[model samples]
Target: MTDQTVPRKPPRRARGEGTVYWDKRLERFVATRIVGYDDRGKEIRKRGSGKSRSAAMEALRLRVRDYERGLAPGADKTTVSDVVKDWILYGQGQVDDNTVKTREFNCAHIDAGIGDVLLRKLTTKHVEKLLRSMVATHSTRTIADVRACLNSAIKRAMARDLVDRNVVELVVTPRGTTGRKSKSLTERQALEVLTLTKAHWMYAYIVVSMLVGIRTEEMRALTWDRVDLDSEPATVAVWRSVRKSGDTKTRKSRRTLAMPDLAVDVLRRRRRDQDADRVKAGADWKDTGLVFTTTLGTALDSANVRRGFRSALGAVPSVNPAEWTPRELRHSFVSLMSAGGAAVEEIAHVVGHSDTSTTERIYRHELRPVIQTGATFMNRFAAVDVVAPDWHMEPLFRLPGEERTAHA
Candidate 1:
């Protein structure tokens, strides 16, 4: 009989190539690879199990690839919470306390949604789903902040080879709940607020904010050394803020603004009141040198300011304290300037915006739709009989003889 060639058994896999076999008891395929040696020189193996041999081999290949790419043997087990907590703990360096707090708050939302998801198994779909779930209760800005926090956390993970990619970067942010709109007080309402709160502690804060348009942060950080009430046309330096760097929000924000008579008057009275408070507190006074302070002479925080502001507003029957924030005083300043026919460019400079575009964009609701400067110039050139509004004839600072000089 002609000798039938027997098929030789398939060559055994080389060492470290790994092994795949059907588990007779479990009735499923399993794969294992020698990833490394333990501290005791024992073999350290990584395993993957699946219903099919190909699936098991694929799972094993992924683990091996991660190990070769410098990831730890159990890198696939790292979860979203692990990465986020790590980043929140260590990734924020030299940042403001407020910035760190904001990241922690935003990251908490991420952990609540997908904290248990494995980093290796995370995908764009997972991130998108998490964002979509937030649409009902969170604002678009809040949603965006959450996504940014996750993206940063994932990037940190990738640096450590815990993840291969940042799936959050690939996901598109979805629309979220409508946020509360910012509003400005009308001139009459602003006057009412000022008059009603005159005897209250927030009087000077309200006057300076509404008239000079200094930010709440800047107002909180104002110091005695920066005020120049003794000089002609008194000024206040807006060179610092409560930010960690102690710099103004922008380079343009580091300007010295001439205080209106109203602002100077209120600030003077506030200084006297603070002196009285210092005597009252005696040794308890902290002497922080801030323009606004608590009873103990400590700096005014947002909570303290808000509580006082609301209590002051309670005296004004026409104005609702619940609907307004201290920041609205700055908005009211913009509105009054625009209504008084100040050019957008001039208002931009006073508000420390780099350009008119920013001023117009942020204060669009407060700005007039027309170009008033061109019309005013044309009216003057033609010697038109058209009368201007009372505010148009009045200077913002209302300095002595300014109105007469403007008319002349």
Candidate 2:
């Protein structure tokens, strides 16, 4: 009865220096210890809360190690830019410009915003503030992509020993949990943009972009042989892309696409037109056979595409209210395909997407249950609309009626 009156503490066993057990309203087996002792013997206490006595003892041991290493539980410090740069340089040759450009930009944003801060110094409050600041200046997708890059950078940094651990990984991204998709243009808006594009002195490239869903730079590397104009179901062989490097965008970009009749007709006209231009120039047009090219027949510049796109948008009367860039035209094309009830897989393939899920996510608003038709609509009868009937190639510098066809 005398022993029962007292609490059955673990007999105050000393597993290590300054470690003991204390009983309270909770379990009696909790191991409490002074992790940092001083000359007066007053120090920080780490209390373990495990049901198992051995587990409590283990916690006591871990807390001592953590004190020795100068950290409390769950304290970490790593910066967003620090992680991004480590991964970017780590993956020197792995990703292309399209990938690296966004990553670099995101890294720059992080460096500008909070790169100097320690990882442990980053708080949820700091992240929210930085995110709000970026949102104020950039589009939702751009900000989201930047966040993703930072998160991935931290993950890779951890792998490379650049960081003790990734605190960025623990923090939720500003956009991922928000569930927002990039803005897709309406069909009418797209048509208006397309009409403006046709009149803006870049018809050949614009025609290909709308009809075939080829990216702007991919338009630069297209050649005559890769396009099959005579086939019943004509096709565009996307063999490469024009990159910032004066060459194709990616080795994986050389995929074949089943062209719609509209796109096929557009390509045929452009090819015929370009061929005539070459004959007139005699030797100026390089014999590269690029479907869309500069006057010198070299890879087209990205800036030129942007300028032309901007000019086209400015030309439209009704489109004044709708703010969109040239790249939005790509989204417009995808949106139209989705609206047409095309199968998710079909749109994914035609658009050179890796998976159907990507198509569904981007064009999620356009999905319907007519059955996953997969690219079968590409074989549908040609509904090619002629933008210019009886159109012939005009000499670049010659007046309209004075323009003469140069035979190659």
* Best model number under lDDT: 1
Once superposed on the true structure, which residue ranges of model 1 sit more than 4 Å away at CA? Answer: 1-56, 67-74, 95-99, 373-408
TM-score of each: 0.78, 0.58
Best by TM-score: 1
Q: Write the per-residue lDDT of candidate 1 for residues 6-109, one digit (tens) a residue.
A: 89975788876799998998888999989899899999787787899789988888887887787866687899999999999999976789899999999998
Over 4 Å off, model 2: 1-101, 119-129, 132-139, 175-201, 243-255, 280-284, 310-317, 365-408
For model 2, name the residue pairs that clash: 76-120, 77-119, 77-120, 78-119
Question: Compared with the true structure, what per-residue lDDT tens digits does model 2 show for residues 233-290?
Answer: 8777886665545444445455777777667766667777776777787767677776
* Candidate 2: Cα lDDT at 146: 69
lDDT of each: 0.89, 0.65
